[model samples]
Target: MKRTAEKVLSVISLVFTVLSVIGSFIFVAIMKTFTEGTLRTEIEMELYADPELTVEDVDMILSVLEYFEGFSWFIVVVLVISLIATIIGMIFMWNEKNPKLAGIMFIVAGLFAFILSPTSIMLYIAAILCFTRKPPLAAEDQSFIDNQYDDSMRPL
Candidate 1:
């Protein structure tokens, strides 16, 4: 049961991780184009009618926008890193080795997967499952346990 659960959860996590990586990259690319060209003009035109605003204020605002663009790129970098971490976590989950560490990696990925907020939430759930799930019994051990159970249940 735990093996099945872990496999399902790991596959789901991979799907979400891919979605998040693609979405984050697309969003950043679109935002970069918009901010570099149309956004500045839109902002200036929108603020043009304000009587209290001066040229310097507009300049400051555009500068701030530039800073925000840089910040967004930084976020994209973090998102990429988070995606990598998520893949690593998925690998660990699939191999069924060091689940506690895998859970921690998932948690870290979740923290950094901010662009697609739901992905982070899903990753967190996956992490929780990883941490709480029981390890699967070896096949021979499982067969032995089954035989013992059968003997115990027999009429004597």
Candidate 2:
């Protein structure tokens, strides 16, 4: 049952990681379009719609967008890092050799992606469950391993 759960979690993580990469790519494209295309016109229309608006108001809004444009690459870098971390974590989980650690890494990576990507919450929950649940190691098998390693070196 635990192995089944771990497999499910690994699948979920893999899906989320792929989605994160796609989402990041989409975000970058959208941001590029916004900066280079109709966003300025939209902002100008909105500002001018108010009868009290002045040149300074338009300048302020354009300046803010310019500032955002300058930092857009930074956002891209962050999303790329998140995508890589999530993919690596999913691969580790799928191997199932160290699921607890892999699950933890996945959860952390998912959370990071979720904050910026908003679509990774599902993966984060699955990873959390995998980390919290007891693995399917049988008691007898655990005891055998314990004896081989000696009690002092055994995991509690």
Q: Which stretches of candidate 2 lie over 4 Å from their true place?
A: 1-27, 33-52, 116-118, 139-156
lDDT of 2 by residue, 1-156 (tens): 445654665566556656655765676676666667677688678887888878898778778777776666665565566566666666666666676776676666666664544435655665777678775676564444435654577666
Clash number for candidate 1: 0
User: For each candidate, what TM-score against the reference?
Assistant: 0.67, 0.59
Query: All candidates' lDDT scores?
Result: 0.75, 0.64
lDDT of 2: 0.64
Candidate 1, residue 12: the lDDT equals: 72
Residues forming the 10-long window of minimal summed lDDT in candidate 1: 141-150
